[model samples]
Target: PSVKSVIQGFLPGLALKIFLIMLPKLIMAMSKMEGYTSFSSLERRSASKYYLFVLVNVFLGSIVTGTAFQQLEQLINQPSSE
Candidate 1:
């Protein structure tokens, strides 16, 4: 593959990894900004936010990727005369 394709393939995974690594800190910052009085409350809010983020990210990512792959398969298998 060409360099452009190689970079394109690698960048998404790299970016995702970086985002996941930073997600906890990001959540904690937001929790602090929300003005939770106790550490426990802040922790709880951060945990919930992190959980929701992960759940939605995975759920939507899977659906979109699956649909894209299905469409790609159809395109590849279709007759060229259309």
Candidate 2:
């Protein structure tokens, strides 16, 4: 490859790396500007509720998935008549 093409290819990737590296710091700075460091009691409650919501969702989802798989297995393993 020519030098220009090589640099052209590398420039975007290097820029992307630099942008990604700086992104978290930028976000943290913005959060600080917004007074985002403090947590409240309500936030803890909301987090706990979110965890419970996820658990309930997973529980129901697994039950449905298991039933579907059981039905699929029964259909797939049915004996073939000659």
> RMSD in angstroms, candidate 2?
12.7
Q: Identify the runs in model 1 with alpha carbons over 4 angstroms from their true place.
A: 72-82
Residues 1-82 of candidate 2 have per-residue lDDT tens digits of 9999989989977975676566545555554565656655445444555456446655776798899999899888995678
lDDT of each residue in 1-82, candidate 1, tens digit only: 8999989999888998899889989999888898887989988999999889888897787899999999999889994785
Candidate 2 local accuracy as lDDT? 0.65
Give the 10-residue window scoring lowest on summed lDDT in candidate 1.
Answer: 73-82
lDDT score for residue 78 of model 1: 94
Candidate 1 lDDT for residue 66: 95
Poorest lDDT segment (10 consecutive residues) of candidate 2: 41-50
TM-scores, all models, native as reference: 0.73, 0.43
